[model samples]
Target: MFIVFEGPDGSGTSTQAKILAKNLEKKGLKVFTTAEPSKNILGKVLREALQKKYELSPKAFQLLFFADREQHVQNEVLPALARGEIVICERYNWSSIAFGVSEKVERKFLENLSSSFVEPDHTFFMNISAEKSLERVVLRGEKLEHFETSEKLKIVQEVMLNLAEQSAFTKRSTILNATDSIETIAQNIEMILTPMLFLQNIK
Candidate 1:
């Protein structure tokens, strides 16, 4: 199964993804956990450009992200999934649609671009207030990247929610309230995923 976690910055997607992967592993499932921008050379360059150099235009960023994703799918995710391993990814095509396309490129073009990639079997969108998300990021003492501002993050968050609601791929998606306590959120995710995992085992 391929599962993707989507949300804005500081939305606890990383935290929940880790928890879910560990729980699945403990269940004796073969699990692989990864994220994007991936650790590949293309991904590394894109990550640096996005955060440190700030030289990437919106179209450039979008294309770089997709390039990294193509490499990621070919190198990591698709292989694991083909082997019937449970794959968990933090962020995916949805992030590009929300942040890169909506802000800079046309929505229809972004949708078409994303359709070329492998869609997740299940995606979890962690919803949180933009203000709270920004606060959490600042509290973590992380340096603010060009796209890390509260305003931009809010727009991305809204776009993600909207896209999830409207997209056919999101029929398998679950929206979780990310403002809740960590334990509570984890429990909610487990509740949603465990049954599906069990069903897969039976199949």
Candidate 2:
């Protein structure tokens, strides 16, 4: 299954993704865990530009993200999924749509561009308040990235919530409360996902 996790920064996606992948591996299932703005050359350059230099126009940023995603899909995601392995990605096309639309990109164009890519079989939307998520970021003592400000993060959070509510992507999406403890939240996600994995195995 192509499972993607979406949320604002500091939403514990990385932590949970690791735990879930490990648990799945323990079950004797092959699992591949990765994230966007991947560890590739193209992805690394864009990630550095975004985080350190803050050097991309809104349109350029969107395109670079998609480029990284395209490379990631071609080189990593598709291969694992084809082998009947579970592919857990930290972010997917929805991240671009949410971020792009917030940057004033036309919604229709963003949606169409994103739809051209493969959609996740199931997406876990880690829901949290903008204020709370920001606080978590601060507590982590990380340097501010281009999207770190309260204003920009608020916009991203709003876009994510709005998409979760209205986008067709939500059909295969599972909403998780991110404000809970890590263990509780992880358990909740596992409860929702374990059955899906079992069904796939039977088929």
Candidate 3:
């Protein structure tokens, strides 16, 4: 099964993804964890651009993201799933959609770009206020990315919520309150996946 976690920069999706993968591994489940923009060459370029090291128009950046995702799916995600492992990804298609729409890019174009990629069987949307998201990022003392500002985070969060509602038609999605304690949030995710894991084992 493919499981994805999505949210703003400081929404802790990365942390939760790691914790879930760790715990699932202790249970002896086969798990493969990854994130996007992936570790490939194009993903490296996108990461640099996010840090203001490169200037790209919104359309250009989204196109790079689309291209990176194609490589990611082919090179990493597919092989893990082929081995019957549970794939847990920190970010996926919705990240592109939310950030792209927030930057005023056309939604249909973004959707069409990702239409061929694999969709997650379950998506967890970590919902939090823009102020809270920015605060968390600042507390980490890391250099802020281009989209890490409070105003941009506000727009991105709203866009993600709207996307989450629309996503129900495609797959299972759960909205999580990211302000909760880390352990608590992980527990919530474990509860959701435990049953699914059981069903998979039986099948």
Q: lDDT (CA) for every model shown?
A: 0.86, 0.83, 0.91
Order the candidate numbers by TM-score, best to worst.
Answer: 3, 1, 2
Task: Report RMSD for candidate 1.
Answer: 1.7
Report the Cα lDDT for candidate 2.
0.83
lDDT of 2 by residue, 101-153 (tens): 76777767777878878888888888887788889999989887767767767
lDDT of 3 by residue, 1-203 (tens): 99999999999999999999999888888899999999999999999999999999999989999999999999999999999999999889989988998789998998888788988889999999999999999999999998898887998999899888888666588888999999999999999888877887723
Q: Is candidate 1 or candidate 2 better by TM-score?
A: 1
| Regions more than 4 Å wrong, model 1 | 167-170
Question: Which ten-residue region of model 1 has the weakest summed lDDT?
Answer: 162-171
lDDT of 1 by residue, 1-203 (tens): 99999999899999999999898888778899999999999988987886767686788788888899999999999999889898999999889888874456777777789899887888899988789889988999978876787777888889888866765354688888899999999999888887887788722
Write down the TM-score for model 3: 0.96
